[model samples]
Target: MASFEVIGGRKLSGEITPQGAKNEALQVICAVLLTEEPVTITNIPDIVDVQKLIQLLSEMGVTVTREDEETYTFEARNINLEYLESKQFVNLGRAIRGSVMIMGPMLARFGMCKLPKPGGDKIGRRRMDTHFIGLEKLGAKFKYDSSDEFFHINANGRLKGTYMLLDEASVTGTANIVMGAVMAEGLTTIYNAACEPYVQQLCRMLNRMGAKISGIGSNLLTIEGVEKLGGTTHKLLPDMIEIGSFIGMAAMTGSEITIKNCQIQELGLIPDTFRQLGIKMEFRGDDIYIPTQENYTIETYIDGSILTIADQIWPGFTPDLLSIALVVATQAKGTVLIHQKMFESRLFFVDKLIDMGAQIILCDPHRATVIGHNKQVSLRGIRMTSPDIRAGVALLIAALSADGKSVIDNVEQIDRGYQKIDQRLNALGAQITRI
Candidate 1:
């Protein structure tokens, strides 16, 4: 385990660039298996999760070439089916949640695939029923191995596409089904599909490779099956979650920071959601500028009631940023309820903030009440342990603005999602040492 010792109360003034979106990179890297030709992707984030996925590809026999620090070409001409059944595959797949998506391309191209129970942050009951149900609707058979705890999916022949109404708008589930449906035998209509920018980018990249997908940014998606897909170039958008984290970081620390090349168009409703939390931002030529501020006030409804910040599916405030919002609200000038409806355990990290002298009420597993300090007093730092990727970054932000030395353990969780986070923040005048 790695830990970060942070000396707080430093005013960081500079510019920072958001890394390539991690979720988008996860989806696109798996799509490379949909074709034998070389697929090149640029602006890939060098985070642990992405690197693990790349390693999984190499283990499965994809020819991965590093073109540069931020670019890679992947060619899956000869996939090792034998490796798919080995313990190495199961161990590798069990290390990350995104590995479950391999079933889609595997069934699309090879008509069969198997995977062990994938692992990820235990934020909530992230059900795989949606993935299995959607894939089964596409004419695939599923079998579970009790001893091995592995899932086996097979199609007698090429999959026959059809209509599927997902029980929930699952992002990874939608991506998996879309990849499988692209090379199926007929047309596929997916209602109640996830229309997140990550999903839209996946569809666009597939379309660039000859997949026919309609309704790129809508909930209802229609995909016409094709015989094959060709390789093409794709660039990932800047990470919106990271951008949101930076916004929260700047606000909490009273730092004047510029976030560069943030694909402002793809980020729908995120800026406004932060604005509701009283973060003032400027749109400066594709960048987001946040000047230093002594205080910011939370906005209330027209009825003059306490504001409620909640997370929903895409086109709504993302659940990933709810933790960030909760942290930012701790320093604002009003009271707001942070509702994390999607994940039950995500709000539990607020207890640690309470130990650091924050005014937070853990109402329940899914909701928290934060009473802002109003910049009259600063937060006192303490030692803490990070629980997950998003929560770890929130704690890091809290530590940056705290009044004393703070040590964060389990920082590997932070590294899994963020690309060189300590170095990036250090460049902005933050004192963080990794040990």
Candidate 2:
């Protein structure tokens, strides 16, 4: 029920370290359940989702020892599979979509797993059909009880891998199958798998734990089933989404800020895509330094035409960040069309942006056209509530550049990913307070 009160138009300037990637951390923590020995994860962000996952694991009898604020050592050696059927475990399953991942590990080790319907951003229909289909290919039978609303998966004896061509490149679906395939017999060939950074990180971590996986960053993955996995320490990668958020914030507020320890190589096309908005940034070794600029303009095509920014799958722009990019475009000096192709409900938040005096036309459920300030108008502040994770951050960026006070409610949605967001923005002189 907490909210953020921000006195807007403050120049955010200073050094701000990005938290560990939330998506990657979620997958990595779930990967720990695949091993019986102690697995230590460093640079774990203190966020709501991570905390919820930790509580779920603890209720299942996994010993999670926090060595420090940013590190946790977890051992699932003594986890009771019976807890997977508990009402408390089913209740916590609604806390995050990643809770579905525990299904694979529990079934792999204990031959049975039960999970309630997972919960996450209400961006669109994130079907679990891919997950169930992939697991079915690996010899797991699923039964759904509509009255109780739980999925019961049972695998008698050892799981035998078969050829699985996922209907779509579902991120969590690919992760769940990958964990399940690690313990199956024979080879598991996964075609059209999700190759996002978080998926690749899970494959890498499983490899470190003795799972044989090939094609680490591609749509086709081959996993030779292994009998057992051991423990290993793995550092979570720098959050590229957080990096994109920082870039959007710096550009909108016209602040000079340095983001340290960014995994620049893994950023793929994110930096170049942001540069298209005329936001100047420099790479200083592992750090990304954003400098102050006046009158930033949107880049036009070669024939002097307006351009459009869109999102796609891996090796392309991420759909998760299209909301942030759209907010940044409002402060630029030209017009750009943003196409959010993946989620149908994502662009609906533009009405809030339009109320703050932004010139935006919601062309459809998945697209919007933004006409920048052209250095003539600035958005005035208004009271609003955050709707989702990426959209919430987009509103925060808008609030920072607006003229007066803006109060944003439902801040717990923001805390699910970004760690200590107010403190980090405060370091950059943003007048943001949590109440």
Candidate 3:
């Protein structure tokens, strides 16, 4: 129900630090359920989705102590396993997609867990098959109830590890399976696992907690089951999606903004992908400095073909930032194609951009060709609605660069990912007001 009233055409200049990774926070927070010892986590992003997950864990008797605004210590020594069957738990679980991850640790330690259908963005159909299939490989049985839309999962005894070849490289699925395998009877090998920086961080943290996990940053993961795991402190990397969004915002609004503590090395191919879009950025230590620019041109292929930017697996451009790249291309000097291969409905938000006077051709559900105005045609601000998290931020960036004022409703979607985005951007001279 919240909205953002953004006044466009204002140049922003200041330094903003990206928040901790949202994806990583969800995974590591759920990993706390694997051990009864206290797990201290710092640099946690205070976003809506993460807060919901923390609340869920606390309600399950996980003894969550807030050390500070960005730090917490979780001890799951007295978990109330019976809470899983309550309507309150189901309501809370279905509200956020991250709640599904707790099932892995629950079944691994407590022998049983139940989950309602998880809810998240309506971008596309996100299946739980990968998670179930991987868990089943380690001696787990699952039953689905169509009447109540609940999933019942149980293991007769301690999980027995085995090898699994995932049908897809799903990040959350891989994290769940790895958590289930960490305390199994034998070794577990996972192929085609998602090797994003988030997953790598989880694996490293697991190893720190006395779990034998190798292949930290590759598609193949090897896990040697241990009888138990202990607590360890973990810190999250800066959110690369937010860093990419900031770079796009700077290019579109002719702003000179420096993003601090970006963990640039873990942001694989993100900087280079934005560079291909002609957004100039400098890497100063761990910070990214994007200078003011009136115009930036899109780069074409060597043989004069129109450049196509598509989302692929890790080490490739992330699908989460494709919307920002598409928006940035609207004001660039040349044409570029944005291929959103991961989600079919993600590119549908271009209709809002079109209403703002950007020249974009929605080729299909999966592709869009943006013909840049090169700042020749100033976009006129208008009222809009945020469809999802990434697209919401993309629209907000467009509104910041438009000629007049714009109101974006349903900003809760944006808050699910970005941490106080309006306040952070407003600190950098952006006129974004929460209404």
Candidate 4:
């Protein structure tokens, strides 16, 4: 029940180090169930979701040790499959959608996994059908109890891999199936898979655990089943979503900030998407340097065309970032159409922007037309509560650029991803405080 109070119109000028990727950390933690040896993970973000996952793992009898503040050593040698039936497991499952990933490793290792409906951002209808279908294709039987809101999966025999064409490029779906296929009995070919950096990191971690996986950075992946996997130490890549958020925050507040230790290579097509809004960034080694500027303009296509920023599967712009991009567009000069194709209700938060004097046309559920301020008008400060992870960060960016003090409630939603966001912003000279 924390909230952020921000005094706006402050030029942020300092260096900020981005935290480890939340999405990748979740998958890597779940990969611990693939081995009995201790898997030491460094640079782990101390976020609410990771804490919840650790609690869930401990409830399942995994030896989760906190070596220090930002390091954790997990050994799932004597994991009790029965723990999944415990109320602690069920409650933690409802806190993070990533909890569903445990089902794959548990079923592969222990032959059974009972999990409740996973909880995450209520953006839209996020179906687990893709995950269940993918695992079912790999010789797992699934049972659901509507009244109890739990899924029972059993795979007594060795999983037999098969070809799977995902209905959609669901990120968690791809991660779940990847974990299941690694310990299967045959070759697993996944087409139209999610190839985001986080997913790729999971594939790499599995490979480190002796799993044979090809097409690491492509939508089509081939995973050769292995008999066993061993523990390996893996470091998480920097969160590109946080990097994108910093880019938007710096631009909206006309701040000069350097984001350090960013995995620039993994930020594919993200920089280009931000460039459409005329947010210029310089890459020096592992750092992205954003210089202070006045009057940023939105870049359009040739022949006076309107620029459309949309999200697709891998190699395409990510839907998770579209919310931040939309807020950045509001501060730029000119207009652009922000299209969120994957989730229907994601753009519903733009009405709050319209209330702040930004020109935005909500074109149905999937699209919004944002007429940039051209540096002509500033968004007035408003009190709001965060709706989801991405939208919460978007509101933070808007609050940083507004005319007066703004209060953003429900900051727990933002904590699910970004770690120590207020401190990081404060390091960048942002007038943000958690109250």
Can you give the lDDT of residue 241 in candidate 2? 91
Give the Å error, residue 66, model 3: 0.6
Q: Candidate 2: global Cα-lDDT? A: 0.90
RMSD of each: 0.6, 1.1, 0.7, 1.1
- lDDT tens digits, residues 166-219, model 1? 999999999999999999999999999999999999999999999999999999
State the lDDT of candidate 2 residue by residue for 326-414, as single tens digits: 99998788999999988899888899999999999999998899999964688999999999988999999999999999999999999
Off by over 4 Å in 4: none
Global CA lDDT computed for model 3: 0.95
lDDT of 4 by residue, 1-435 (tens): 999999999999978888888888988899899889889998898888988998889888899889988889999999887677788878889988889889788877776788899999899988889989999999999999999999989997888889989998888889999999999998999999999989988998889889999999888999999989998888899888899999988999998999998889998999888888999899999999999978788988898899999998778888889999999999899999999998899998898888877889998899999999876889999899899999999999999999998999999999988888998788777888899
Reference-based lDDT, residue 348, model 3: 93
- Lowest-lDDT window of 10 residues in candidate 2? 103-112
| Model 2, position 141: C-alpha lDDT score | 93
lDDT per model vs. reference: 0.95, 0.90, 0.95, 0.89
Better of 3 and 4 by TM-score: 3
